[model samples]
Target chain A: MPALILFWILAIVCIGAALTMVTAANPVRSALSLVVCFLALAVYYVTLSAQFIGAVQVVVYAGAVMVLFLFVIMLLNLGAPVTSSTKGSNQNTAAVALGAILLLVLFISGIFFEIPGKAVSPATAQAQGTVKAVGLTLYNPHLPWLFPFEATSLLLLVAVVGAIVMTRRQV
Target chain B: MLTGLVAYWDNLRDGIYRLFIFPEYWHGIRLPALVPYVALAGIFAFTLGILPMLIWIERVVIGLMQDRTGPNRLGPRGLLQPPADVLKLFFKEDIQPGSIDVRLYYLAPFISMLVALSAGAVIPLQTVTFRNVHGGLYTVPVTPGNVNIGLLFMLAASSLGVYGIILAGWSSNNKYSLLGGLRASAQIISYELAMGLSLLCVVLLAGSVQLDHIVNAQNTLPFGIHWLPSFLKGSIFSWYWLQSLIVPVVIYTVAMIAETNRAPFDLPEAESELVAGFHTEYTSMKFATFFAGEYVNMLMICGLNASVFWGGWLPPFNCFPFTFIPGFVWYILKVMMGIFFYTWLRATLPRLRYDALMNLGWKRMLPLALVWLFLLAGYSLVRTATAPHITPTAVVTVAHVAPGR
Candidate 1:
């Protein structure tokens, strides 16, 4: 019961922070609001018993990625409120259309799709969220996840190399 | 009459023990549920309480190094100077620069202190044994937040600490402050990679990310040489500083010094260049908050080094006299030694050039850490393959499962 209450509180914080991130005029404020949103999401992960994921979420997104975001914003001197002349452009109509499509997709999935696995008990969820459990599941040869995990890592490496190549002409 | 007196003394001892260790209830509330809260408060007090002493220790050590008397007038050997300084900070006029962002400028120092304090949650002070209803003894680590992913949590908190400096620099509306913040974010990000990698070496060897598990893994004969005498089982030699071949420890130490923004790596606040850096515009208690936060961060990082690399709470040797000392005392002593090392380095080395610092962090430490990690991982894999009968993972799982909470 307490966990449920805490989850609701975090849910409110997560949504509020996301809204603030979208609406804030200053780029630095927007990035910081996004960080708060990420943190709230990480807490929600912990409450759902995905402890490893929660830690990774904060470490990767809130810690590393958002710092880079703010670094770029500051480097480019974009902390001041941006004044764009394209405010009433067709981009707004396209954004609204995309948002409607996304909402429709989420609603349709929620109503029609049945999740594959059985609902795990709290004890099992706790067990599954441990570092050991996650490691074994990801690395076990018998499991189907190992190949996909390696492939995703390879893709990330390729992306990194591509970024370096694009940035450094001499290199 | 002597027997009656002895009985009374025994009763008094038992009453005190029960009151502290096995209290069942307190004013209609279950006491066991409150242990985490109590431990949290204790951790906070311990961190804050040590700040003044840490400041005094740093001053005295630096003074000795520089052949100065230090703060000798306030109390016996200037023991009272830190308190005086704190009082002065409290009474000083609070200043806010006219051009600064009011909200974030006010928020930065609090963020600094908050992040520093939060990182202490997962640090295990010591293990305490208690008697259960079955009259059997069980030992549990006395951490405020004994989560499984403690090492990762520390990494996250330390990573978040960069925001405080960056915000302070940006909001100060000063060129020096902005530059300081920029340097801090870049330096921290670069060093964090090496730091995480070094910690990963420990995690790989311990086969667990939990701090207590990492500490306990060190309490064994070096290289598991069972032929050694029993007295040599849990000694300083068994610690990860030796077991991991000293490379990761060296890397971690350098990275940690950089991470904490201490001297030699303290380009962010280079006195000659940046004029006090991020806190140039801060004044009074707000400035003090940033100062305390830096010291607290130093303590937290040093405590981590002590626990992860040095044998935390474990005696240098598992001998009769050494074992007689309490575990937390040993832990604190080791942590203080780490602090002394910090002071020693601060006095000895000059600040690195900006480009040189970046080169050391990225071009040097990052590649070395990666290579070391690869080598260690290969070695561990080969060992596990050869010694299939005695799998380390199996042992780790069994040990972890047996201590179910």
Candidate 2:
């Protein structure tokens, strides 16, 4: 019962903050809202018994990376309520239409799929939530997935190099 | 009927008593003792300032190590210097540069402190006993969130500390801070992967991710005998650090030093190049906040290394098995040793060039970590296939050890 209440509270906060991130006029407010969203996501991760993942989420996204985002936003003087003259109303309409379609598709899928049975509570899941479980999963039957994990890291490397190149040119 | 009423009255009395004094009633049942989370917080807060105290200590030590009086005017033999400097920094007006984000700028310090504080949660403190109303005794692990993911959480949290410096640099509206932040982010992220992998080697040997479990697993020396007896017999004892893990430890130490952004890897604030780096525009308390954050991070990283590589809260050798030196003392000593190393490096080493820092993290640490992890994992595989399966609890009990290490 308590889990239901907590999940509802966190889910509401997360959705509200995500909305605020988009709607806030000031970019700084938007960034702050994003931080709230990250925090709420972390709580949700905890509810899922992904304690390590939740901690990683906080440390990497909220603790370190978000600070960097905020720093950039602050450095850019994004606190000001800036006005934009360029407004593509047709583009906005199209985007909204696509988003609504996607939502509809998800709803249809949810109805058709009828979701799987609920998993055990986090307390019960603790038995296999250790680092060993993650390692075993990473290496054992899921060894094929290793190729993609490595490939994704390679992609991150390329992106990082690209960013450095772009920024260095400016400097 | 009277006897039944009397019993009913007794039941009602107990119910009312429990409703009013629930905690007291609950105490009647044996439960795990609570780790003093506040005590951990207090100690972490204390360590945040130890860097400056370390500065003072360094000066005193250097004076002792060499032959000179370091700072005599601030107090009797310059004892008051750090506090005075801190006071001056406090009174200096905080400057928010024009065209910078104010909220993120202010938040950088809190994020840094939070990461530092979170790292201490997994540390084991002294064990306590609790008695329930039924007079049953229960033993509880004193570490907060003594879940199996202690080391992982520490790594992730320390990784988060990088953002504070990155954001400080980027948000300052200064080129120096931006460059510093970028370099630090790149450096820290790169090295953290290696640190994670290197620690994985030890985790593989222990077959568990719990820090206490790892320490306990180390208690029995290699080949089913103690290290001393093995030494007398001219056979090496099997602590993971001594047995095929020397390379991993070295890799771990190097990556850890970089992770903490200390000395040679102190790229974020290379005054020579970046003019105080990320906090270039910060003044007064803002500057102090960044300073305090770095020191706290250093302490945390050191504590983590000690816990992971050195048997954290584990007394050296079984000289006093059941000899009760409290767990917190061992934790403190290990952390202090790490701090001492940081101080030693400060006195001895110069900052590395930015290119060198990046190259070391990628070219050296990452590759070494990868190789080391595979070796450990491979070894574990061989051992597991050949050896019989041992449940973690059975191993613990057979080893004749306490759960808290």
Q: Give DockQ for candidates 1 onward, in order.
A: 0.53, 0.27
Sequence-dependent TM-score of model 2:
0.77
Off by over 4 Å in 2: A1-5, A20-36, A55-86, A104-123, A126-171, B1-31, B36-52, B62-68, B75-77, B126-139, B222-240, B320-324, B382-405
- Candidate 1 chain A: worst 10 consecutive residues by lDDT? A134-143
Highest lDDT against the true fold, candidate? 1
> Where is model 1 chain B poorest over a 10-residue stretch in terms of lDDT?
B387-396
Q: In model 2, what is the error at residue A44, expressed in angstroms?
A: 0.3
TM-score, chain B, model 2, is 0.79
DockQ agreement of candidate 1 with the native complex: 0.53
- lDDT computed for candidate 2: 0.69
Specify the CAPRI tier of model 2: acceptable
Q: What's chain A's TM-score in each predicted model?
A: 0.84, 0.79
Candidate 1, residues B1-405, lDDT tens digits: the string is 966875676566556545445434446675555656766787788889999999999999999999999889999999999999999999999988998999999999999999988999998887765555566655677788889999999999899999999999999989899989999999999999999999998888788899888998888888676688665776999899998889999999999999999998999899999999988999999999999999999889988999999988898986555765778889989989989999999999999999999999989999999999998888767766665433355344644554452
**Candidate 1 CAPRI level:** medium
For A45-76, candidate 2 gives per-residue lDDT tens digits of: 87787776776787678766776675566556
